[model samples]
Target: MSTAGQEEPDLRSIYHASGPWTGQTLYVAAHLGLADLLDDDPRGIGDIAKATASDEDALYRFCRALTALGMLAEHPGRSFTLRQAGRALRRDAADGFRDGVLLQSGAVFRAWADVLHTVRTGRPAFDHALGMDYFEFLAANPEEARVFNRAMGATMPAAIAALEHYAFGTCATVVDVGGGDGRLLASVLSRHPGMHGVLQDLPGTVSQAGENLSGVADRCTLVGESFFDAVATGGDVYILSRVLHDWDDDNAGRILRRVREAMPAHGRLILVESVLRPADGDLRSVLGDLLMLVVLGGRERTESEWAELLESAGFTMRQVWDDPGLATTRGHSVIEAVARAEADRPDTAHSSPPKAA
Candidate 1:
């Protein structure tokens, strides 16, 4: 009855010890495609092994591990079905994150192995592991590239919802800085008929936006150039959706500065990112932050962190919005920052709003 006072102790140590076991077991199931196989039918361990082409004994061990982890139910019949927590891996579902999760567990896992090196060197694990940066690695590995890009783009629905809910009452021409494949930009452009768009990104990335932006082509102009080298000018709203997180603060600042240069004093920058929060019933945000650490050498930033970044780039945060209920594996937070126009400021001669289309 007095166990609490006996050691006052090992709870923290126990939890910390269990962290790797939880993640590794999930990775094991993902790697073996066990859940995907079971999605079709409840299978015996032998059958699962046959279908996945895995060794039977190893498969049994894997299944036993999953069953112990509460990801599967094992009965006297020696057959297995997914537990409620594991059924999300089924491949046929419209929003199934199987591919994304598999891609991470398989490919990104290697990059993550170099996390210690990254910490020591202050460089991306991806760069150190592959001998090239992420975008460069993507350029060379077409298949893996698509998987990675899809995983990135898949977060758009929640992001789009947050954007639509935020007040964009005054924006007309909106420029999507580093908008890959134009999905997020297209969503915003579609929502506001009065708004035209400039989808600015790398030439290769912009080329892929053609098919994606077809429906919104009439209102979107695609501009291909390094955001560092050139950014298209003139827009009331400039967006950097999921862009700032890919680089360190210095480069992120450079991008914001470029957008600030192109934008008038009153222009607004809509920063769409997964805002990192402390563990407050939002585990997705925490997981995503760790993902950034292992995969990109980037960290998921807090609102205050974002504010500091924005301020350094000559912009100020005016509003921040989130739709956690709708977020994917990565929670969505839409931060709206404004580049104050002379008219809106205290010191300069007030100027009229930019011309609308």
Candidate 2:
């Protein structure tokens, strides 16, 4: 269809041509270890080929494309070096994002192809497309599992920073409900020497927690149980980090109620998640929202949505903290909600003494 003397371009045709252009380049870079090879200085194509054992012609083509994409820079004759865009490629760098990129490119890239199906059905496309749910799929698949852990690990620092500034105040114990491998718990206990932590998760997950928490073993008690089935009772603070986003509203409310039941009269519930803005203006939050829809059958929530969920679960939303640029490093920021403990329970506080006796 031609319009206004300009031929209408075929949308699908353009997509088809550019579809795998960048992805193929990333795959080539991953295979060649080009970033690691150029970690020192610029190198000619022949040296890079000999080091990675790649064909000279293919290596030259890959490097040229990467250079065009600004991921590499050409020096003198046939020599290339890492550009600013390629800094994340080095594995040993302090702020290296190589593992993060590799993980996204590996499993997530494959799963994201079914976005349309997930959108149509509002079910997890990972399960439908891969024939298994995410955790189950990762359990038996070690490479994918390692990638998942590394990807999660990449966000721990920001999460830790958020927890560091949060007001714990007079709380003696914290139970990390649905804590994955106890990373956040360990980080908290390391910061607060007086506080003790009870780390709870599924039996299969606890074994991994045992390995990850070896350094802080003395400060944490690891429990093996599903959050849906059981949780440790009576902690002053119940921390749910990155847990609620994996569930829908009803299920999320149930999880919050379970935590409330296990809390004391004056206890607090801390929910740490990336709070989604209600509107579509924020591209990052919007993309995260879509990701939740496609992969987890959940959605990134607005502050109001989170407040509603918590209130329905018998907790009042006390406050929400700003995550600042800390969240920008990763895709989302940390939002903490304080849940009131004695709202639903009537008999917790003893009646006041008769006129001060």
Could you tell me the TM-score of candidate 1? 0.81
User: Residue 98 in candidate 2 has what lDDT?
Assistant: 70
Per-residue lDDT over 121-143 for candidate 1, one digit per residue giving the tens place of the 0 to 100 score: 87778778878877777788888
Q: What CA RMSD would you report for each candidate?
A: 5.4, 7.3
| Candidate 2 displacement at residue 313 in angstroms | 2.5
- Model 1: residues >4 Å from true position, as ranges? 1-21, 75-77, 277-287, 323-330, 340-357
Assess each prediction's global lDDT (C-alpha) against the native: 0.75, 0.74
What's the TM for model 2? 0.81
TM-score of each: 0.81, 0.81
Q: Ten-residue segment with the worst summed lDDT in candidate 2? A: 348-357
Which portions of model 2 show Cα errors greater than 4 Å?
1-20, 53-55, 209-215, 278-280, 325-341, 344-357
